[model samples]
Target: MERDFDTTKDVVTNEVKAKKSAQAKADAQLWVVASGKGGVGKTFVTTSLGLTLSKLGHSVVIVDLDLSGANVHTSLGANPSHMNIRHYFEGAKSLQELVIPTTYPRLSYVQGFWDSWTPTDFSYNQIQNLIPELKKLRADYVLVDLGAGALEAHLNLFKTADEKILVTSPEPTSIEKTYRFIEAYMCHSLKENAAPDAFGNMITTLRDHRQRTLSKPFSFKSYLKEQTGISYTFFEALSQKPVRLVVNSCRSQANAELGHSIKSVCHKYYDLGIDFTASINYDNAVWQSVKSRTPALVAQPFTPLAGQFLNSCKHLIDPEELRAVV
Candidate 1:
């Protein structure tokens, strides 16, 4: 059975290779969009961002890996279909076979499961395999919607991407959850990449600092520098993959600036610098587009929501752009 599976994968690889254009050979950049909790507009952001990119004449694919909430298709006005990731896992189709085009030109997506058991048990090994297949797609960008939470499985996908965009609202609960998610992600990355001794020391120091100064926030960077004084490689590696943050549902200038505040907290406490890429205002057009089952960029291209998505994509595509809290 293992041999048969390997043979099948090889065949799919060759078939995909044959179908690729010169542009596809360059490989698509994987942009993973996730949230610390649900109802933070993660899927909406994914669809809108992809739509904006497509308008720029870049081919984009949005994969609804958020199996539990799998509504990327609905948000993009694509009807339900059996062409989903579950079929790929069942060996019934290749990832390439599952690509379904959206109504918007240059945009496409893979439907996720609905009214069925979510692939919550999707293991790390499976993600490693899945990413290579995603890269084989003939697109300039592949936006993966990872739904929510800080589960180890989710963090693995989040950290493995070429770019990571974390979506959150300005609500207090959302802000708290986002921080917890980042902490979980940091711990996960440390465990995976740090030496056993170094990992143990840092973790212990973090816990001790929290206990001693319950009122004061713990900064892993300070402890690592003062005590461990031995290894800076892990943090240096983390610095290279700074997560991009997007604050959604902002109703005021203060709400929009929440992203900047979160960015400051992350840099100070976690020693991680995250880009405050966008702050989407609370606009009726956004939810209206959701009700119409069309992306805001497509349904109301002239709306402020569309403009915000455009800015988000610009910052994502070109990190050198001066970021401002919109």
Candidate 2:
């Protein structure tokens, strides 16, 4: 009777595990990680998050979409494969064929081209075509590392993601650039979805006005009221995409406060709710790991930075407040 009871318990445990595996696959998420500028640890964050998610038993693919400077392969201590995004663009390979397994189990990579042969003009139609194909990839989380700056292609990729994450450092310039990037994203989204005449004219007018008055701050709410016939609530609801911010290389408590300050200012000025999800501490181990081409989580799993990465991933999985507010 005791032997039979043990067998039943093992069977139940196996069944539960199988159910969770199936559910995780069914609920796959695509996350796009972008930054306003380079040297803000965007790739590090992307690789670490991918490793963390995979370690948590979720299959992950870290795609390098930084067309100008693709280096995600170096972050994972792997050499670039012949099959990359360039091949996909050249019609020599499918998106699935571009995937190259990394050293880490359950973690794959789709390398981008780093040479001069990289495609210069990625049309919107191409991006639209790529999105559905990317969704078909076999991974629980597809993390795309976008190029620095707010280029049209980068913005489109960010918009396509299920979760858009912006990485910024504690520096003032980085913060300012991040705000501008968010503004550009919101404007692009508005132009795409909102009525062409009204929204487009409003954006054009606002650009000219801002250029004319550099000293004055532009208020999105005020512009909406004065320029468009659209209701503020309806417009806000239409533009209500939740963006997650991760403050990288934070050293002091003041840095965390600065992140919150940026969030408050964005809400007040842009009427956009920004979720400041994680503050990664400035750790020497991160640099060491980068230098060695190993992920920080693998190099220093017990460090505070690793703990923060795990916490950030968890928050991203189910940001309750962000969901409720959005």
Candidate 3:
């Protein structure tokens, strides 16, 4: 694998930096891949998709944003001790300087910090600094691999993506956690955008409703629609932010339909329409490739898993097929 960081390209002029930043933001697409819980092939999907895009002649950069877990480099067959995001976090290097070329043509990645010393939670200033740098990365597609769960940092990072893909397994626990993630993200977005006084009362009502029955399905849409104080732009933003769902490790047709079921639930209760992009079946080649520290698409290019990754990339790259909430 080509794990070299190009340090020869230095001493860039201010005008060149400004022009490059503008060009990158104008051309590149940022895709954030996340999961409700770990153990669901989120990083695998990210690396596979990045390889697929690269094979199609697009410059792809896979960023391991899952700082605490930080294993994208391992999956891509790169040394973990090589220059990573820790250098950027510790002020030893800029974010752009951390980008390292992968073995595949047109593919590169920014490794995450796996050391315990790296902060698990970021402050507001850190997020502000990191996001712009991420947007400025020069690539056709920038794939960010987020850690599992609905942590504030994850949701904040997720909200800024040009494309958001929520990966999940078909198991009952995974499906439930996926729903909880969507709910948490919805509430997080509202907390950030909605009027504080109005949202405060809304939260109290939500808490009261939760106390009625553990089986009661949560519905934030109906309650929010009833409120007259909140601005329409809040609802518009919620309606417009489309999430693409990918169900991984499927064993049967029923397992494949889980993505659709989750999408239906989100539209019903959360007022968000999520695309059921692709369902990848259980394949031993996937694990075998990972065990060898290589992406499945690159190691087993002729396998069924590679075909599925190609299909998923096609669905993801097309902008018109994305469904917005009604």
Candidate 4:
């Protein structure tokens, strides 16, 4: 049976290669999927969305960028390829060479390193160099599953994406951490784009102040008002970056409504516009599929959870307005 499966995969892979060569260079839309905390279903969402996009006739590459704890390959019921991101980082392979064809024809993956092989520290220059190479891949869409937490590396990677998807559950702790992630990203953006010296001083001052006054929320708008020159207008214009939010493991209607509540709070406090795109119900099928090493959609295409994921993809593709389908 294993031999038969290999033969089928090889045939499909060859067919895809032929199709790829016959086509013109793909202008892919890059998406970065991230979360504030670990085990929030970020990888599950990424894989399901990539599969759904491919099923819609778009070629998609899901790159597992969660270097420290990479396991996106396991979710696809596949082992790590010999050529992965680690090889690319070590100069043994080009970014293009790292892409391995999956059993699904339109979906490919750039596998990630295992825990033992994960790098302790990846420099900013390395990440900056990776961005252009990723953009050069020929696919309709590229989904990068980022590591959880708001580390500088993670936030920088999130910023590089054309569109960013932040995943979180209804738990209070998860929501709090998600807000912190957003705060960190906003600070990172300001420091990079605005007056570096002034913003740096301001960030330091704010950090000290926050340590003293733990209950107060940091206000970007208020901070910008006090600043002079480019920093002021740059932050004002930062509102243009839209982040889509997905609420996962929702058990009830109230839990689902947390998406909207978070959006409202962000708009009021952070002056950041967040779109509450989709809420996924707490379904046992999701875990079952994961345990079986199959994507939920592929394992049970007609299930409600699968339908919800598809709807979320449609809304993501055409996000002129929010379509909350829980």
lDDT of 4 by residue, 1-326 (tens): 99999999999999999887755564578899999998889999899898888877778899998866788898888887767788888899998888888898689999987644424656898888888788788887889999889988888888878888999999888999998888788788777656767777777756765576535656657767776643555445545557889999999999989999999988776667778889998888888987898888888888888888888888778555233432
lDDT tens digits, residues 60-118, model 3?
A: 89999886588888889888766888788779999789899987788999988766673
What lDDT is obtained when candidate 4 is compared to the true structure? Answer: 0.81
Model 1, runs deviating above 4 Å? 1-22, 211-218, 226-231, 319-326
Decoy 4 TM-score against native: 0.83
Encode model 2's per-residue lDDT on 51-170: one tens digit a residue.
Answer: 888777778888888877888999898987777887777789898888899888899999987664635767888888877777778887889998899998888888878889999999
On a 0 to 100 scale, what is the lDDT of residue 323 in model 1?
Answer: 35
Rank candidates by TM-score, best first.
1, 3, 2, 4
TM-score per prediction, in order, is 0.85, 0.84, 0.84, 0.83
lDDT per model vs. reference: 0.82, 0.81, 0.79, 0.81
Clash pairs, candidate 4, are: none
Model 3, residue 264: C-alpha shift (Å): 1.4
When summed lDDT is taken over every stretch of 10 residues in candidate 3, the lowest stretch is 1-10
Maximum-TM-score candidate: 1
TM-score of 2: 0.84
Query: Best by lDDT, which number?
Result: 1
lDDT of 1 by residue, 1-326 (tens): 99999999999998887776454478888999989899999998888888888887788898988866799988887788867888887789999899999777889999987647534558778888898898888888899999689977788888889898999998899999999888888888767656788778777766776568445657667666665425555577666778899999999999999999999988887788888889998878778877887667776778888888877787677655233422
